[model samples]
Structure formats: C-alpha cells, structure tokens
Target: MNNIADRYLLHAAFPLSMDNESKSTTEMICIANKKSVQEQQLLQALESSEQRYEIATKITNDGLWEWNLNSNQINYSSRWKSMLGCSNQEIKNSPVEWFARVHQADIEKLRRNLSACGQGDVSQFEMEYSLLHQDGNYRVMSCKCMAIRGTEGKIDRLVGCQTDITRHKQTEARLNYDINYDRLTRLPNRQLFIKNLQELSQIESSCLFGVLCLDLDRFKYINHNFGHQTGDCLLVKIVQKLKSCLRSGDLLARIGGDEFAILLAGFERADYPAEIASQIQQKFSAPIEVENRSILITTSIGIAPLTNINDLEHQESSYSLIEALQNAEIAMHQAKNKGKACSVVFESAAYLQSIAKFKSENELRAAIELEQFELHYQPIIKLADRQLVGFEALVRWQHPDKGMVAPGDFIPLAESTGLIIPIGWWVLRSACAQMVLWQQDRPKSKLAFISVNIAGKQFSQPYAGDIIAQILTETGLDPRCLKLEITESEIIENVNVVLSTAEKLKKLGVQLSMDDFGTGYSSLSYLHCLPVDTLKIDRSFVENIESNIHELELVKTIIKLAQVFNLDVVAEGIEREQQCDRLLELQCEYGQGYLFSKPLSLAEANNLLESVNN
Candidate 1:
C-alpha cells in the first residue's frame, strides 16, 4: 500500500479542497505523477470515499452544525439552514445570531445552560428549545453539543446538531398533560397534586396549611340515573365552580372521579382554612342546571393541617400529603355517613385515635382475604306456621387480638374504604353455599330462601351482577332460593340502576326484595317499576306496632301494596309476641328478629330449622 502521509493528503483534499489557481497545470501534473502506482491507487480510494460521504451528508435530512468557541463562529449544513426555513446566505456563523433565532421565551434558559458549560460547571450540553422559522412560526429544536476542553481544562471548541423536534415535542407535551391532568375537566390529577403539595411544603414559614379532600356525594346515583356522560359533564361543571371559589395560590386537583383535593397554604390563622372550607362547601351546594333541571350538588370535605414545614425541603417529594389526604377522605366519608353536604377538619388527636381503627380496617381486610370472618345466621320464621323460613347472614369478625367485633362497628368503615366489595362478595358466596349445605341435609323442609342484605355501595359496583352470578354458579345454589335484599332508600336514590340490576338478577331467577320498606319515600309506581319479589316492613314499624295506630296502618298499607303487586311481604325486627300477632293479623307472609330469635350461628339456626320442621 501507499505511505500514510500521501494517503492522508490525498484523502483530505479530495472533495472540498480544490486545486489552487496559483499552481500551474504542469505543477499539478508533476505532483500527481511523482506518486508511485500504489500511492495513486490510494488517492483513487480516498477520492471514492470523499464522494460517498458528500453524497450521504447531502441526502440525509438531519441537520448538522459546528461551533467555534474561540471566534464564536458557527457552521451549519445546508439542510440544517433549510430546516429553519432559511436560505444558506441567512445562516450567520455566530452563537449570538443563533440565540437570536431561538424563541424569546426559551432564550434565557438556553443562555443559562450554555453559560454553565462555559464556566466548566457542565461537561456536556443537550437542550430542547424553540427556534423561530423564517415564516415567523416557532418550531421546537433539540440541540446536542460536546464541549472540547483544551489542555487547561477550558472549553475551546463546541460542536452540536440541531434537529427539528417540533412534532415529537408536541406529542411529548400532550402525553405529559394527559398524565398529570384529568382528561374530562382539565384539572391537575393526583400525581400533580402531590407534586404541588411537596413543593408548597418547602417554604420556610411558621404558618400552617390545610389539605382538604372533597368528594361529590351521591355521584354514583347521579351517574346511574343520568348516564356516565352526564355525570362527567356535571363533574366538569363542579370543577369550574371549585376553581372559581379557590384562592389564587390554593391548589385544586381532581384526584379521582368524584374525588378532589385542595391545598390551602400560607394560612396565618388556624381557623382560616376551616372558614375557606366552609365557604367552599356552601358554594358547592348551589344548584347547577343540567338536563334542563337545576340539580343541587353537595360535597363532603375532610381537612388535615400540615405542621412540619421543613419535611419537604426538596424539589419533589411526598410526605404526609398522601396520608393526610387519605385521612381527610376517611373523615369526609364519616361526615357523609352522618348526612351529605358536610365538612370535617382533622384534629391531630382525633386522627391519632382514629388511626388505630383505620389500621384495624386494613387488618380486617387481611382477615377477609384469609377467611378469618365467621358467619352467624339469624333465623327468619313463618309466624303463622311457626316454621323456619330462612336465615339472615350476619358477619362476625373473630379478631386474633380484639376478639368478636360487631358489624355496626366496622361495616360502615369497610364500605368507605372500598373493602366492602370483597366482604359483600364473601357474604353472598358464604350464605348461598351454606343454604346449599342445608338443603342437602334437609330437602323436605323446603325453606323459602336465604336473605343477604346488600349495601348500597355494593349494589353500585360495576361487577356486582357478575359477583352474584359467580357465587350462585360456584355454590350450586338455586338462584331462586337466594334473596338479595336492599334498602328502600338505596333503590329510591338509584332507581334506574336498581331497576336494571334487579331485572338482571330476576333473569337469573334470584329473588329481589326491598328491606326497610316504609322508611323511605318509595312511590307505589316505583315499586312496580322495580323487579322485586318481596317487600320487608321495617322493624321501626314493628317496634311501635300496637302503640301507634299510624304505624299499624302504614304496615297494613305496605302489606296490601305487596299483595297488589303479587309480591311477598315480611316484617323485620319483630321483637315482641304482640308485634308478631299484629304482623300475623296484617297477613305478613314472613317475620324475623328477636320475636323468634336474634342472629344465631349456622349450627343453632340449622338445629332450630330441623326442630321446627320436625
């Protein structure tokens, strides 16, 4: 092969380096001929290589650039100039000239970053900034540079490439917004809320701040009646109201559907946050026009105060916000249970006391998963025939340490925490399975059905029908033998979804009953609209049966209503013999509660059933 010196000279000057005019044609020929055949062959190889590189650079669309830090001169490829809608003549080889083309809004940031590289603070440079096109439009450009340091460790040369990443940047921005903001209402989502909370927590101040978690009460009922689209529209309208009511600095976020969180920072006085929350509650209670009807919406707000300001001293970190938010939500749910349209602020002492209970809820969740819950069946007997009809499933928690826990103490807590869905499924499955076991032993008794009281939240679950269907199929229990009981208020609140769910169950041959019938403003027309097989007279009416003539009349009317609809009638909470006689007198088909027996265990209930049938 040729010498390295000849090959290097031949290759370097092959493409861009043209023969000098000062050099005569004879001198050019003498220089070319003086080389041996091997060197000539190397020159030919170098020329071929230059042609390929020149062709490749010209064909590719990516913009390439070089910057000379010493002279502040910049050289950009022809395609690079074209990328910014500029001609070759318009391309000035100066950093200042390049910065001038950068969008004004992004210039300062780009300057700071470049300054950091000049000061030896940064070794490499990469930035995404906007460049003004010749057409006066801004296109996003991504620049990547390598700082060439001299022997003194100072940057002497910088080379970079600028690519038009406008489309990619737009896509990235859209993705970021979709991640951090709610798509329906365009409000900050839970992730963004936590981030803001963390940032706000870092301010060096003695002033306290409050985190209020609010949920639109009975939103599921609205969704069930008006459809999800209308529900979403209402949520968006609610978000607008919430935004209007907030202070300029306060952060409002839609953390979950129907759930929101607000950060009230820099409160000088402790009561300020509470006052603001109360004002917000009042504002939210105002009616909104939807579907050509003015509908009043209420929110349940729970507030927790931030005591430690130094906790989040970093740019982004979550501390106590998520926990505080969760506690506020729990307290809000507690207020909702009292009644809707209420607000509760978290007291540290009260929260401390309640934290144990909340922890126990998680423990109870584990217990349910591990099958630590036991079912005690309460007998419902035929008062007229004095024969056992069916059993009501009552859940008892046999806590490893706390012993037996009452349903009243924990069921509401479970419902609020979303643990009720699993618990309710277990109840239905266990009850149906037990009923199947009973039928196997005593096929002759011919008990009417096992009644499982379902909560409103459980009934509202999207997969509730599937849960019941699976339970029935898995246990091999006749669906007709399983009575899924619900409250009158639950049905009345979500009348449409309730009716739809009831029809779905009825198609599977499961009996539907409205429990505590007279307690709510259930219209007779609604009763027929729902696919119910039975109406349960509330125990309140039974307790005052003989003493109150009105109670007796009401019970009689309910029984007559049931008869007219060809539905079975049962009176619950029957505690007295006189109440039983009154119910029998009213021709109520079935009765339950202390009149016959309180909720018993499976063994006690089965034994009683066997004896009564015998």
Candidate 2:
C-alpha cells in the first residue's frame, strides 16, 4: 500500500492548495483498493482456467505429459501416472521414467520419432505403441505430441497426450482371427489357406512344396445315421487325429464340410507327401468313439506338388492359387473313384481326365434331356431246357456324334454324377412296357419276366418302391413280370435299407435278384437274410470256369450256397459251349451271354421273341 500510494501521488498532479498529507492519504487508499481488486480478479481467472483444464483432462481421459528438451526432464500429470496404474508419488518427473515405461520393442521407434520432432523436421507426431503398465502387462497406447519452439526457433519442449487403446487392439485381433479360422475345428479356413498359398507362391525358393486335399469317406451316411451333433464331434476328433500325423511346420486347414487340406513346404523329397498321407490313413484304422458310439471312417487324399514356383508361373502365365487347389481336388476325386481310403498323386494325365470328365458330364446331361438313350434286351436262357424265359434290359447311349457308346464307356460316369437315377427309371419303364406289349402280342405264350438293373443310388431312394408301383400301374405290366437286379456290393453296403426296399418291392409281387454276386463282399451271413429269389454269378467267375479249376470250385460252392438258400442261380458271360455245359452241370438254373444272343434292339428283340414263340 505505501509504494502504491507513493507511485500514484508521484504520477498524479493534484491540487497544491489542499493539504498534501490529507490528499496523499486519500489517493493512496483509493489506489491501494483498486490494486487489490485487480490482483484478486487475475487470481480468480487463473483458478477458473486451471479448473477447466482439469475437467477437460478428466473428461477426455487423456494423460498429459511435458518434456523439457534442454533439461531432459519430463513432467507427468497426476492423471498420466494414474493411467498406468500408478500414483503421482510413485512416479518421478523425469524423461527416464517415461522411457522406462515404454515397451522395449517400441522404445527405439519412439526415440526416433521424438528425435524427428526435436530436429524441427516435423511439427508434431502421432504414434501407436505398446506401453508397460504397472500390472506387468503391456497396453496399447496412442500418443500424439507437438514440439514447442523457443525464441531461437529451437525445440525447447514437447507436450503430448496418450490414450489407452488396449481394448480396441484386442477387438481388432479377435475380428482378424474370426475371419481366418474355422469355428468348428479352430483350424485355418479356406480363405486363410488361399492367402497362405499366395504368400508361398511369392517366395523365390527352390524347395519343393505341395498340397494335400482330403475327403472323408461315407461321411454323409454317418451324418444320416447319427445326428449332425455327433458328426461335428466326430469331425473334431478327426482333426485331432490328423494333426498328430502332420509335421510341425505343416499347416492343416478345414476347407469345407468333411474336407481338409494340408500345405507342406520346404520338403526335399517327392515321396514325403505320400508318406504323410499313409500315416494319416493308418491313424484312422482305429475306430473313433464319439458320444458313446464307436464310428469308423476313412479318408481319400490327393497330393499336388509344386517343384518350383517360378517354373510353374513360367509354364502357365495365367496360373492362379485356386487352380492349384483344384488340381489337388481332382486328384482326390480320382482316388475316390479308384476306391476310397487311398491317396492319389496329381499328374498331368489326371488333370486332362478331369477336364474330359467335365465335358462328358455336360454331354450326358444334354443327352438325358434329348432322350438319346435306348434299352437293349439280352435273352436269359433256362440252361436245363435251353429255352428263353426272360430278358435282361441293358442301356445304350445312342450318341449323336459318337455313333453307339457302350455302357462300359459311361456307366461309372453316370453313377458318379447321379445321372443313373433318371436313366435307371427310364430303363425300368421301357422294359416293363415292352414286356407288356410282348405279353399282349402272344397272350397264350408265357414270358416269365423282364429283368431291369437298378443302380445303388436309385435303389436307395426312399420313394423307389412307390415309383416302381406307379410305373407298373401306368404300363399295365404285372409286377410278377418285372424283376429288379441290384449289385451285391450295393446290397451289402446298405443292407438295412436294401432289406427294407426289398420287402416293399416284394409286397408289389416283384422278384429281387442279387446281380454280380460273388464279385464283392460275398457275405454268406447276409445271404439268407436277403429276400432274393435269384443269385446271378458274376461274369469273372463264369469266364474262367472252363480253364481255372479254382474258379470251377468257387462256382460249385456258389451254386451249393444258392441251393441251400433255395435261390435260383444265373450264370453270366457264357461265351463258350464248355462254359455253358459246366454251368448246367453245376445245376445253375439260368444263363445269359453272347453264347445265347447279344443284347438286341427293340425290333431285333421282337423278331427273336416271335421266333421263339413259333
């Protein structure tokens, strides 16, 4: 107050006539009061600003930090220390403290960024890095900082804000994992497998690499018999077994349902892929127990090798990663065709065959639409009387361009593509109608039956019995005049379903014959259980019966077994008189082969029937 009054009095030229002491005292009181008011206002404004800054820091949850470049000291806000789970007293106001809290891997990068800002190369910098927390875990943090310059235009200090992004980072990682991994097996999915293949293709390595495509055999049946829940558990167990067969560096992925693939890299030996496939198959030999049910399964595998990525690229300019996978898949299908539970190595020949098969499948579909198929009937002879009692219907493809295509050329293809279903129905209806026509033409003559071959898939259809009955009603053919022949393998593989189908057909007065018996699973155990009226000896045994005594004995045993079951025997492929005589001597009831007559066209068959009646 004294200095304020003295300065005020010295600056002010008040009236000299008044008492100097009294005027000076009054003026000093006024100046002192005004100075006190100004000082109080300034302090209030400073307090308000500090309160606002604290609220902002709290609202934003941003930890503030200031670094004095000259003194190499850092000032950390209380909030900053608390962000790392530390108290203000626990942290020191020093750059060393901040640097020590940074992750070791991120420390060098942080220093380099800070150096750039200090050198005035950047006005500010933003970086996301890992920071060590007080809980001994690293937290992802996003830091934004700006350099403050001094009067000499040199960096004097740095001020920054750090935000904890640990949750955000975890969410990002989880999303990435979900996209690339299978949910059921936790293995890499198809997308990740393709990505890995692409990455491998980019590497300039001479080491050999390959892919293995595996498919579970009869998995659909398992799914149908057991519920999908059990099937899923089975698949998981299968993954565990497959993993045990893989090398450490190999990658296994579940590409699709019941289909898996393995990527083998850096292997020098060409046979290594086959060895792994064998091991995997061996592991499946033991039955897997799932949900208290012991399930047996096998896999078909295909292997495609990549000897040199560069060479492959050079060979096909349009080469793609998907094509590599497709090639392996094609080989896997080939293995399935050869018989499941085996592995096939991809080759140029197999690729070409796949292409051909694709074309042929399309052609077959078109042919079915255009009705380019016809039935040829082969006469079935009663060996004792040498009389024609029935005819077996065979399918022939009357190709528009290829003249006549034999069943051997396309039957397997038809079976694989499920074309056999429609084609099989067509044969059945045609054969039955033709038999009705023959019966109408010669009402007095007896035509025992017309035998039609039914495919395994067609027979397995639930509505097969109903469909056959409908066809019979439509054609006005006696069910007793139509005999259905199913292969032995088809019957044995699905005995329960086949038995049901057989009972249904039997109710319709249709006879069942086991076609190609003795060629596959000649299980005498199921023979008596089947309600079959006849057993047709396979052509292989009949073909060698003349010269092969072992074949003759097997034929004898088959005939005796048929007799024991009270089932009629039909010998197929009797190409020679000796074979026919031998079959008759064995008491085989019926026979059909070139020795009688080849499969005949409709007009030829009509002529033959008339000749037999005459």
Candidate 3:
C-alpha cells in the first residue's frame, strides 16, 4: 500500500506532458519509459475507482452528469436521460439542453445556488426542484453539483448527480394530508382550518367574507343509539351534504366532533351568510344513509362576518384566528338556545355585550351571595275546574345597579359562564322552601307541587341528582310535591347523564317534566326512554293555535304523545279565553299563562292561594 501511494503521488505531480523547468523532452521521455510499471499500476487504480463510482451510482439509481466549462458541453448517463422521461437517443449533449428542461420558476433558484457554488461561497450545490418531463408534466428532482478545480485553481468542470425524488415528494404530501385532514370525514382538521383562516386574513381582497360554525343537533343521541361506525358514516354523509352548499372558493372543514366550519368569500349581498347557512341547513336535512338506514339531522349554525380587514389586523395581537372561531361558537350557542335548526349572526353589539356580560357575571356571583334572586310562581290549573294543580317557579334578579334585569338578558350570560350551576341549585332550594312555607300558611292550599326549570349545564353534571336529593331533604318538601322541568335540548345534549339523572330523581320521588316540548330535535324513541312525568307545550304553538291549524295539530299530537306514555300534559301561555277553550277541547290535563294568573311574588301568590282556597 505504501509503495502504491508513493508511485501514485509521482504520477499525480506530472500526469502527461509536464512543463517542468529542469527536464528536457528527451529526459522526460526516458523517465516516463523507466517508470512505465508505476504508470500502468496507477492507471489500473484510477480505472478501478471510476468503475466503483459508476457501479455505486447505478445501484443507488442516481443519474450522473458532467459539464465541460470550456466547451459548454454536457454528458448524460443513460439513467439521466430516462429520469427526464426521455430515451437515451432523445436528449442532446449540450449545457443549454439541460438548462432548458428546468421549470421556469425553479430556474432562477437553480441558477442562484449554482452561481454561489461556482464563486466558492458554498462548497456544494444541492437543490430540490421541479424539472419538466418530456411528457410535459413536471417531475420533482434532487440535484447536487460540485466544481472540479484545475491546477490553476479555476473551476474547469462541474460534476453532479440527479435523483428522481417524485415518489418521496408524494409520500411527504400524503403524510401532511393525514396530519391536516380528519380521518373519518376527510375534511380539513382544526389545524388546517386555522392555517386557512390565517392565510385568508393576510390576503388583500375587496370581497366580503364570513365564517359559519355549524354543529349537528342531537349528535350525542345518535352516537349513543347507533354505533361509532354508523356515526362515522353519518359524518361522511354530512360533509358531502355541506359541500353541495359551498361555492368553488369557500372552504368546509370538520373542526371537532359533530362540529364543522365553513369559510365564505366573494359575496355581493350582505345577507349571504344567512342564505348560505339556510342552504347548508336545507342540504343537511336531506335524508342520508348510515349503515343502510336513512336518517335526517339538523344543524345549528352561527355566522361571524369579517367586517373590516384593518380592524382584524388590529385585533390580531389581542385576538388571533381563534377570536373569529370563538365568536362563531358563541353565536352558535346563542342560536342553539333559541331553538334547533336556526342560524344567528354575530353583531358588533354582541361583542360589546361581552364587556357588560363580564360585569354581569360578577354581579351574578354577588346576587347568589346576597340572595338577590327571587322566585315568582305562576299558577298551573286544571282546565276542567280551574283548580290549582301546581306552580311553575321563575327566577328574577332585582339588581340594585340596574333596577331589574330580565332573565333573557342575563341567563344566557350565566349559562355561558357556568354560573347557572349555583343559580339553578338556589332556585330549586328556594322554590321548594317557599312551597313548604305556602303549605304551612294555607293548610288547605291545593298546590300539588312547585315546578322549577333546570339549566342544561346544571342538569349535565354528574352530581345533579345529589343536589336535588339534598334540596328535598333540606327543605322538608315531600319529593312528590316537587317537579323539575328540563328542556328537550338539554336531554338531547348529554343523553346518558340526563337520563341517569332523571332515573335517580324519580327514585327520590321527584317528577320530571319536558319543557318546551315539540320544539327541539328529540325523537319519540328517545323521549320514551326518558323517565319523564309530563310534557309542557311550547308557548309559540299555544299563542297561535287558533291562527294556524299546523300549530293546532302539533299541539294535539304532543298531547297524544304524552297519552301514549300516560304522562301529564301542560299547555303554556294560555292568554286568551279561546286559547283556554281550545285546551279544554283538546283535553290538555293542565294549562298556565295570563288566563290563570300571571307569575306572582310571594305575597301575591299567598293572596291568590288564600282566595282559591276560600
């Protein structure tokens, strides 16, 4: 090895026609002849190394290239020509031919990197770029170049290898898709949705934009009744339905379980958000097959329009893309509270109200601490004898600062902030205590029970049963004489928890009533499964029962629905004598509203009780 290294060094110093000052032509020829053995050995080593490099490159499937700087010529191996989707005979051996095949956009980048390498600013050239294939489409390729400097320290030649990295690029893209897309629905996931929002916010455009945050109603019930596999099929059907309602540029993404988001753009009408939301609702309501069973579902949508890009930019520091999403979610909750299958747009006033809402939450805490809440009872009477059967307990806030605040104004704020948990407990306890007091004052009072409305959040708690049992024990009110009213939507949200709670409350001897029945997405199958004692007709149907026959039939159907389960039926908002007559004709078990007696203060309720008893 040492002898080979020494002989190779001598040949490397003077390869062919050396211009050494001390050597004549004759002397050089004689010396070259005498060292012929060493020259032959060196030649064999050089050929072997070249053969090894060629074999290694072939095995790796890399196409080798060499460019002659002086001649502006290029040499391509057979694999290099094939990489460009061309036959060996189809390519030309010229530097211009190689440069021409580069994609227009990538040409500048390739030039920049190569120029930097040639100037000795970088040691090697490496680039991942797109090169035009002979078939006209582009192929992703990875090419690396290095300068071969001559004895004069000048870049005399360039050598590089080109690899076809198209498969690698496809694999990377698939991995990215899995990361940013929902596996079940194939809709863009939350991360990609946020990225899309950020990009949209940064773009300069005159088109008005909005976001629709949609959540499927009664999704949990579906998930519970049907298996997860069926639930996934439903999700895919929903995504397809949503896409039918979208424009070319709009984006639809599944952002959470049973939740999807839509980005709206290029709208001329200011009411496009509502129209689009209605289209989405209509499309979603169409029958879809899940495990060969056709089912229909409704969506509650919340629209948040991007008002001013400049304002958004300013708000970005304090509120990022999440701000818009939160705004949409807030509006969605508001719509859900109104009823199922509804859409609500976020107004600037709603945003401003949030500030006031924060103050209201603090006041709510104070109200609970100071017992500023008052329970007013509205009389529920039997239609046949106008006899008092029960009283529905309604809470009121006598705010010292605001004089009086309506439940509509503050209850939502309380529900959102989870203040409803404590407030609801207080109402149950206060109503039960008052009922016990009224029974004591008028021993002959016909009040069967006090019905108090329960908030959804409060009812969803695992400890909700415990709270009611404790209230019944503390107030000494007979559990049979206390009724709890919960909305159908609440029962639908957490079916398992609410159903379990209802069973426990029943075991405690308390009656459960479904409030505002026939207004939500509760199926009869699900309703029958609940341990409910009564169904209260929503006020909307009762108010216009005479004006609309459909409303009449709906009310009648509700009464029959209760009859099938042998549950008591109560009609609300019976303001007119005709409405009372209509209820009597329908044989509704009980009725409540102005026709009976308005919601009353404790003193007013006691006076009424005494009057009825007399």
Candidate 4:
C-alpha cells in the first residue's frame, strides 16, 4: 500500500499463519512504517529550520534571496522585498527584478562577481554596490553570495544576503571629507593637496603645470584687531572669492593658517599662472565686509613651474613634486620681503640660490655642534680720550674651506633659521669667561665691560635671565661687566614682553643697550620709557657726521636725547678722525669703528689691553 498506516492496519486486522507470503507482507509493513517515521522527522526539522531562518533575517535586518538556475527564477524573502522599499506583490520573482534595481555604475561589477562565483572561479564572494530604492534614490548595499553545486560538481543555484549599508557609506564619506578638507573654508587641506600632486606626478603629459603659493599679508594683525571668530569668518569669505578666480580643473588648498596653495594644470603658457595670480590679487582690491567691519587685505603670491621628469637633463638628480611646492613657498617669502602685495616667479637662479642656502643651513648646524666659531673683540673707546673702556664681542665663522666668513653673509641667515639663539648663547658665555681672564691679568686696566649682541629670539626667551645668571656665576664675572645689546626693532615689535625681560636682566645687574638706534621705528616717544643704559647711534648716522650737517645734527639730537634720559651714547662706524671729532663735539660718550680697530683676535686684544694699561 502506498499509505504505511493502511498497510500496518490491514496486517493487524487479519490473522496470518507461519507461511512465506504472510512473512513477506509483515516485512513490507515494517519497512513502510520506518520510512514514514523518517519522513515525519525530516519535515519537523525543516519547519524548525525555516522558522529560525525567518527570525535570523529579522534580527540581522539582512534580506535573504535564492535563485534557481534551471528555472531562471529568483525567490526573495519578504525582508528582501522590504529592503528595496517594495511589497511582496510589487516585486517579481525573476533575476530581472534584482538586476534592474542595481545602479548602472555597479551593475556590471555585480554581474561579473556573480558570474565568477557561478563558474566555480570563486566559491563565495562579498561585494559592496549601489542599488536603486523605490524612493528613486540610490542606496549602498553589501551583498554576500555563494554558489550551490549539484552532485556533478557544477554550480546550479546562487544564494546570498543583501545588507543596506547606505548610512554606513554616508558616515564613511563624511569622515573622509573631514580628513581631506579644511573645516572652516571647506577647501582641500595640505595633506590632500600633496596626495593629489603626487598622483599627478605619475601622469605623462605634454601640457604645462605649475603651483602658486599664497600668503595673506599681515593676517596676524587682523586676528589681533578682530576676534578669532571674525578671522575665521573672513577666511571663509576669502575662500569664496579665491574660488571664483580659479578654473574648473585648478585646485586651491589652505595649507596653513594664512597660507594657501594652488595647483594649475593644462596651461600652455608659463605666464598663465602669474596672470591668474594677478586676478586673485585684483579680486581683493575691495574691502571685505565682516561683522559690520570693512577690512582690507592683500596677498603675496609665488609661482613655480613644474618640469616634467622626462624633460630633465639628469635623471639621477634629486627632484620631486614636493620640492616644486617648496620652491613656490620660497618665492612667496621673497615676495613678502620685496614688500608684500606682489607676486614673484621662481627662476633657475633662485633655485640655485635656494640649493646653496639649504647646503649652508646644514653646514651651520654642523658648525654649531662642532664649535667651529670664534669671537673677535672690537675696542669701544671713550670719544674724548680715545681710551679703551670695553670691547664688543663679534662672532666669526671659521669655515674650514672658506675661511673667516663675514658676519653680514650669515647673521641674517642665522636669524631667519632661528640658529641665532644657540650661537648667541655661545658668544655670551665665551665673552663673559674671557672678560674674567682679562680682569685677572690686568687688574689696573681701564677695560670695564664686554658687550655682546643678543638677538631678539634670545632676548625673548623666558629663562634668559636665569641663563645669563648661570653664565655669570660660571665665569666668575660681575653682571655689571656684561652688556647685552638689543635692536630697536625688537623693542618696538613687542614692547611689553621686551620691557619685562629687560626688567629681569636689570634685576640681575646686567647693563642693557639699545643697538642700531634711529634706524627702526625711530619713535622718540618710547625711547624714554626704555630701561636701557645706552643708545648706540646707528652706523648710517655716524658715517656722514663729518660732512653732512643733517647727519651731524641728527647725531647731536640723539646724543642730547641720551643725555636727557641719563643714558650713555655710543657712536658706531666712526672710520675718520673728523667723524670722531664731530661725535665728541656732540658730547657722545663712547665710540667704536674701524678708526678704533677692526675686530681683533684674542691675542691682539690682550696686547692692546696691556699697552693701554702701560
């Protein structure tokens, strides 16, 4: 019987004797019962499995789908239909329904992956793509699929799950934007600019390209006058104006606080970048309105043209895209030095000079570490008696090859690189120690003090007073015997900080001098407030004192002013007897120049001290 229950019942109803036919009938009934039991157990397990799968799909929010290869039909679970913002009846059970919803950009890739998996090239695959939702918007979807094989080891059906990853993708995009763009201006930042530049370097093209480095002139003054919030708002507005000046292919990035860089490409002429830079500057001619205030500003721009690697004469030379940007930056600084609100193009001469400066900077650092420097003393004499009273310590670089490099050649460089701080300290300590030795040698000498020039950077140090005190203690020299010379520009730039530092030094009994007076700011209004012991008339004023009445009168007025302030006057660069006589006529107390002696070595200075004492 087809029905196992019926067969078993019939066997039970009839009484059978011990015969072969009856034995066969009993065996058939037993076999049928066993088969029925196994089928029931399997049906129960399958129902339970379907229930678990339903719960799992709901919990994971994943849409499950199955495809029949033989029938060319697809069966999507209810969750899968909902994922596409569709009801069960609205979607059809066909491959067309799934493929039609995929975005055009991603459809081909999805097809390739599915084809590969079905062909046994890959057992399973996971891919992220975009699918169109019922709302007419595309959503990112992550799909995991596997191929089902038949007994012949041929793939017959594909089963997979789809997860809506639209929100996750949006978050990832936001993070990437934040990383690559500036927060205030919403422009690309330095890192992204560099990455794009590096990528562009790999491209082979005949079209010319270049970079422009820009810096807003005196941006710090704006931040100080207005609040930082206003500064930030102004930067945003400036970015808008800057963007209006660019072509579609050009990129503008804010590389620093007040610094920006532009990458220009596909231009045939070399001067095209300069033309664009001019446009950018012209755009800023009008004042920007920010927080009810009209603020005017200007920009300094530098342009550097990029040369293709193939065009280079030497392939082994060190040239990179980054160096191109650096060259542009150097040109920008040159523009600023030429008095801002201008643009400078990087030339081969400038590039060569930059290479030389870079080499010098490295050598300077080595020289500092190796102590390849010496101090020369220039006598500071009493103008009336031409008597030696003190010596100004001058630092000289004893280059092994160049020999006795000029201070004018390297001092400005040192200041720019901030290497002057350590160099200044070395000069200070050495001068102090040498002064003590001189005092011990000639106890009756009129040599009273040693003067050392202190750079603005060194003077601005918070622990300058402490360092000076330690040096004095180490050298066993009196603080009164050490004079620290600072420039007028340094005092005028940061008045309060300079005054405070000067007060600290005064407390340590160290003398202070305003060096290079009348050359910077020349504001007589703040001169009386300065806590300086001397005012050294600049060399420019002293050089013409002998012939020029105007210069002599200016020096006379300066000396008079010093007398009124009870400050000593030191006239510098007095190369002629007439200049010294004129300075003495102006009642200048001290003078130092070529007429007194050019800077002297230690041995020569000691002999002069001995002669003065004799």
lDDT of each residue in 1-614, candidate 3, tens digit only? 34446666676647656666679989978877767866676768877987897787667688888877767778888788888888878888887777898889899999888777767787787898888898898899999999888667888678899889999999999999999999888889989998888877776666777889998999888889998888888888888788888888998898999999888877888788889998887787667878889888888999887754555666453344457787888789778888978999887678777667777788889998998988788999999999998899998999998866768877987887888888899899999999899889877777889999999898889898998898889999999998899998888888899988988999989999998898887558588689999999999999988778999999999998889899999999999989888888888979999987999988898888888888
The CA lDDT of each predicted structure is 0.80, 0.88, 0.85, 0.88
When superposed on Cα atoms, how far off is each prediction in RMSD?
A: 9.8, 9.1, 11.9, 6.7
Model 1 weakest 10-residue run by lDDT: 311-320
RMSD of 3: 11.9
Please rank every candidate by lDDT, starting with the best: 2, 4, 3, 1
lDDT of 4 by residue, 1-614 (tens): 22434454455444365354645777868866766776666557666887898788777788999887878889998898998899999999989999999989999999999889888899999999888889999989999999999657778889999999999999999999999999889889999999988777666666678899999999999999998999999999899999999989999999999999999888878788889999998998899999999999999999987656456454542445666788899999889989999999988798788889989998899889999999999999998888999999999999988999978988888998999999999999999999999999888888889999999888888887788889999999999999999999988886777788888889988999999999886558678777899999999998888888898888888888888889999989989998888777778889999998999999999889888877
Full ranking by TM-score: 4, 2, 1, 3
lDDT of 1 by residue, 13-91 (tens): 4434665666799986775565445466766887888688568668876777766677777777777889888888987
What TM-score does prediction 4 earn? 0.75
Poorest lDDT segment (10 consecutive residues) of candidate 4:
1-10
Evaluate residue 159 in candidate 1 and report its C-alpha lDDT on the 0 to 100 scale. Answer: 64
Per-residue error for 455 in candidate 4, Å, reads 5.0
lDDT of 2: 0.88
